[model samples]
Target: MGRWEPNARGRLEQAALELYAERGYEQTPVAEITRRAGLTERTFFRHFADKREVLFAGSGRLAELCAGAVAAAPAAATPMDAAVAALYAAAGVFEERGDLVRLRQSVIDANAELQERELTKLATLSGALAEALRDRGTDDLTARLTAEAAVAVLKVAFEHWIHGSGEQTLRHLLGECVDSLGTAVARGPGAAGSVSG
Candidate 1:
């Protein structure tokens, strides 16, 4: 390989994803990933901590995007509204990647360890969102609740978007999930009380 090559990080990520899909995440080695990318293992380590990091390298940036969006929301916006804004911001990133996001999800779904890591990443994102809400003057309980609910909406919407036909965008699914959440909340305890045990 040339001493200087552009988009090394992108090449590494693409190579890793392809290898993981072809040979399974657990079975794919770092050496193989580097070889596939036409880069040295030193180059791979420069961009990522390990093979798994190839799949998750964007998590930190994603969290920052979400939290920043929540913090930048208008002062008049409700906590949930701010959280939804974060979700929309995240959707933009996923929408841009399109098939790459779907392929990454498939790779993660095929590995139990990757799935656990994905959950951990989502939990961290929820915490960052809660902190942003608190910075907006929301009370702790309200901030935590709103952030958790927003994350749940994101998770559900992402699953729907990944599995559904290509017609519906993630932003649309997120809006629908938000509406469903509102309907469920609007039903209130009385709605549940009406049902016989």
Candidate 2:
């Protein structure tokens, strides 16, 4: 096992998020986040690059988890299966923090800069997944397309997860989103007309 401080990083992130909501992301300094977390500013720098990094810390970890999942997927798995596996990897990284995600989402919702950073993070995750799939012998086109679809599913599933009961798992929500996507694709665009009948 490695060094762990009872989730000091988690505490700092949660504190920063709460402060972002109350004080605005720009207004909240690193010192304030550390103070709120009952930690020192030195500890904050140990876990993150800067104040802006608090909202983005998960992106790197999630990308690593996704890439590892894609790399470990069975040789017989299809591109979509590999992509789904990458999405499944998110459960371990995010499932326990539905409330924290909800809070972070609210802050991002109110801040344009954070919204752009979120988009960049999603793109980075997609790129990482695509690269991992390519390493697994997937064609470039299939790998990129599957990775994008999977990342989109992750975003939508995470949106759903943050809105529902905290007890619900991220993996379960991801499965739901995947099923919904499949159903919509099977029904085609014409299915929308049926809603009025």
Candidate 3:
């Protein structure tokens, strides 16, 4: 089972997730997780800074992938396009494990603390994406708002993928959200002025 325990990090994450789901995140002890995983407490601590970090396994790496994708996008692409592309690229890492994804999501949904941590991770990812946009010459405000909007779309698309009607793929859902955002952006000042009139 050495190959199965190849990395203490993943073991800790899996153990924590299982325990969290069974006993609630707030109630699950770090000791119990390490014990259940057949690992030492020191091994768990070496991988995760704390119990909370165990719940957010892979978030940092996924954010880096997302930011890299945005930074590499063509300048001609709209901010929404860039954001959606990043999310799409990130989706590749997730699409292979639908069952694990659903289980992890369920655990997060079952706890308010986990939900807050998930939101914070998304916000951090958005900031990274905004910085990538700014590096590509977008103005700060525009980059920040565009990043926010893109993340919102990604969030909706993810939810839809997990819980919505299964007719649309996540990539297609992201593309559709981008198109809708593009329409709103195109309407711009004219749409706003007409509304006020």
Instruction: TM-score each candidate.
Output: 0.94, 0.84, 0.86
Q: In candidate 2, which residue ranges exceed 4 Å CA deviation?
A: 1-7, 165-168, 186-197
How well does candidate 2 match the true structure in TM-score terms? Answer: 0.84
| Runs of candidate 1 exceeding 4 Å displacement | 187-197
What TM value does model 3 have? 0.86
Residue 35 error, candidate 2, Å: 2.0
Provide the overall lDDT of each model, using Cα atoms, as 2-decimal numbers.
0.93, 0.86, 0.83
- Please state the error at residue 115 of candidate 1 in Å: 0.8
Q: Tens digit of lDDT per residue, candidate 3, span 1-197? A: 33435777777777888888888888988899999999988788778889987768688888899989998888899776787789898777767666667768888898887788899999999999999888888899989998899888888888988898768777888887777777767866557769766
Evaluated at residue 125, the lDDT of candidate 3 is 90
How do the residues 37-130 of candidate 2 rate in per-residue lDDT, one tens digit apiece? 8888777888898988888878898999899999999999998898898898787667567667778899998999889999999999999999
Q: Between candidates 1 and 2, name the one with more favorable lDDT.
A: 1
| Model 1: lowest-lDDT 10 consecutive positions | 187-196
Winning model by lDDT: 1
RMSD, model 3, all Cα superposed? 2.9
Clashing residue pairs for model 1 = none
